[model samples]
Target: MPILEDLKEYVERATGLRRPGKRKVSDLARARKPHAVRFKDDGLVPNHPRWPLIIYRGAFEFDERHDPAAVIEDLFEANGWGDTWRDGIYDYVHYHSRIHEVLGIARGKGRVRFGGKKGRIFTLKAGDVAVLPAGTGHQCLSADDDFLVVGAYPPAGTYDECTTIEDRPRALMPIPKVPPPRKDPVYGTSGPLSKLWKKAK
Candidate 1:
């Protein structure tokens, strides 16, 4: 389908046709930060030695089965911007260095867990934008459907080179054995952990 029609379909599904005309193209761009496209090439050449800073555009494709490992390779090649796939609803562990991720939701909806403590459950119809900062442990929860998200990173490098999540076995923890919370319960705040406990109740 045409991109506008696709976006309209999603808006209709997500907002129940609240105001389709009000949705602007800039809205999507505003939701997600601009993908970084410039880089400083300062270490490889001589006198002109401080290699002249060169900006490169990055690109990648994502689908249901694209491997994270393969995506990393593409990222390095593009100086670190590419699409990534999560086989199913899964958690992306935290990282130390800052990364700017601009994601466009091609399908599905769920919660995004970040900063190891805070999270927001966002229902994406399609063409929705989600921007996340680094040092955040991200994951999709309460997701009943599959999704595709295109992400962009800066300066072109691999997660392995800048992050510790890959080095530690327990870094990217498995999906918690609990659902997201609905309303506050007697036990604790309405959260994933609390929901899990409620399930056991």
Candidate 2:
């Protein structure tokens, strides 16, 4: 079923049907302080030491007239995050050792575990966005059948998936070195991310 879903997404993307908007628009619903959480290196998942994962609740808004997923993709693109994709989170625990990631909930709700086995679990709904620093483990625990998420990466680092204890040793060196995203996916240069990340550094 996952493979078939992947194929359907591929076809939609290839035909440019997945994104129907060609113009830039501002649809941010509200501005609020982001909820930041830090997870320690849980032995297996070398969570970032300096940066805390950021969660922006109800960061964007859409109505029946608009396509929420496309709006999320456009916002990320406008803020300099690229390599956008539309899909559900991987069901198993995993992480990116070399790059940071941002996920914007587009159409449904889900329970996701952040960090590793000892990490926290959060419920994410449409309009919510989560920004993950490199080495931060995450997994989708459960979701509604209509759940959809839009993901993107900052331009600064290489994307690498690490899921085993065997990958831990090599993952350490790059976890702290990965550059912070130039702009927050939800806000531009002046966003809280710029200040918070710089302060952490």
Candidate 3:
């Protein structure tokens, strides 16, 4: 089946099969892998933006019988995130100044640094997911041979690359204009991000 067709079914099954009050994505993941999340505070990077860098652990535990990357990608798309792609993390330092980003670690493991050189570092493996707010820099410190990431942005999240503060003034203006997705990419409408992001300046 085509990806769109599969996406259609995924959306229907997810929305149609939901209970009155439950996160379908979380419930779905619970049936496969144990899913978890973490929220970060304002780091070296500065923005009045309302979202945090979300990390979802065991977001897509894959088995020989199940493809986690594909599942993660689908979930993201169904949640109004788009511009999906798959690749290893870029070795050089870079950040998207125009839009936020989400990265799903589909296979293998790696160390990634976020928020420029002064930022924090994280270890990501298969089933891990990281949601990066705009203007935060990141780079792959190291990785295993099979490391793969599925990345995306919210609907129409056209992006640009920035390596330093030179991009800040131009970058900051759009931050407030970027609206949050109706549903959290990993969780659903009632997720923490829904509340935190609304509080963003």
TM-score of each prediction? 0.36, 0.89, 0.74
Assess the local accuracy of residue 118 in candidate 1 as a C-alpha lDDT between 0 and 100. 39
RMSD in angstroms, candidate 2? 2.6
**For candidate 1, what is the lDDT?**
0.32
Model 2 residue runs over 4 Å out of place are 1-23
Best by lDDT: 2
- Of 1 and 2, which scores higher on lDDT? 2
Candidate 2 pairs with clashing backbones: none
Error of 3 at 174 (Å): 1.7
- The model with the greater lDDT, 1 or 3, is 3
**Cα RMSD (Å) between model 3 and the true structure?**
6.8
Tens-digit per-residue lDDT, 8-76, candidate 2: 556655766655443443544468689999999999999998999999999986766546777788788
Candidate 3, 19-100: lDDT as tens digits = 2122234444432222323223234345334556667777554545335555666678767777777778888777776777
Superposition-based RMSD of candidate 1 using all C-alpha atoms, in angstroms? 19.2
Clashes of each: 4, 0, 1
What's the lDDT for candidate 2? 0.86
Which of the predicted structures, 2 or 3, would earn the higher TM-score when compared with the native? 2
